[model samples]
Target: MGLLSKSRKASGDVIYNNEVKPQLVAKDGNIHIVMINSFSKLVNQNFGVESKYTEQIGSVINDLQQDGYEIVDIKFDSLKGQGITGTAEGFHTLIMYK
Candidate 1:
């Protein structure tokens, strides 16, 4: 079975692009591009020192750029929840796409 199949069987929530909706469109050079419509739900959550996390994500993107990876976009998601949600809930997710 493929990794996606296994993940689905395990009831895992997968993150595929920012948009949940899936669509395809032809781009220049006849290249097909898949688009996922999604909003930054993480931004809705409360995170102490939000700017700090944003800066951290920016730094990461900068590093990646320096490494020669063309950053298409950077999405910062503020993990929500409290002590029960784990420390990760307080962290931000830096989604980088080349």
Candidate 2:
């Protein structure tokens, strides 16, 4: 008879406890953070619910920079459908020490 053997292993999905929570760190001895979200969504939230969301997104970005949040980077996802060619799906941003 063959000898019996036992083995153990561990595996599971990693649950994110801090998802979407703003992280602030000391970079170069200054406060730093990064934000990621849909720009169009934000504008829609801040401005109106039924208006054209894309143009408002641009306005919101400009306004944010004007308020001095160190808009370091801006990127956009692809657009879809018609009457919304310049529309961006979302964006990622890196805010430097401020």
Candidate 3:
């Protein structure tokens, strides 16, 4: 079984526990591009210092850059929650290439 399959069978969470953190998944050290998409819910829960979604994304990007990763692209999407039952949310996507 592949890493993804093993991860899925182990837990439902894909990004958090399944995928390797702090390292790019490369095949023979040939992976030159990496993409990261983070939701407000996950980011806020993970990073205790950041109180806002943008702040969380910024913190992550800063860390990655400091670690010698180059930012290739970035995108942000704002989500307006529905009715009174939904909470506002946002998505931050970062593309890094080494």
Clashes of 3: 0
* Candidate 2 lDDT tens digits, 11-93: 00011113322343433445555453433332233434423333333444444455454545555443332234444344444
Global CA lDDT computed for model 1: 0.38
Residue range 2-93, candidate 1, lDDT tens digits: 66345432321222322311332322334232222222223444746544333434444454455444545444443445344343345444
lDDT of 3 by residue, 19-85 (tens): 4244554334342544454434432334354334444445555555665666666655555452244
Clashing pairs in 2: none
Global lDDT of model 3: 0.46
TM-score of each candidate? 0.36, 0.29, 0.45
Clashes of 2: 0
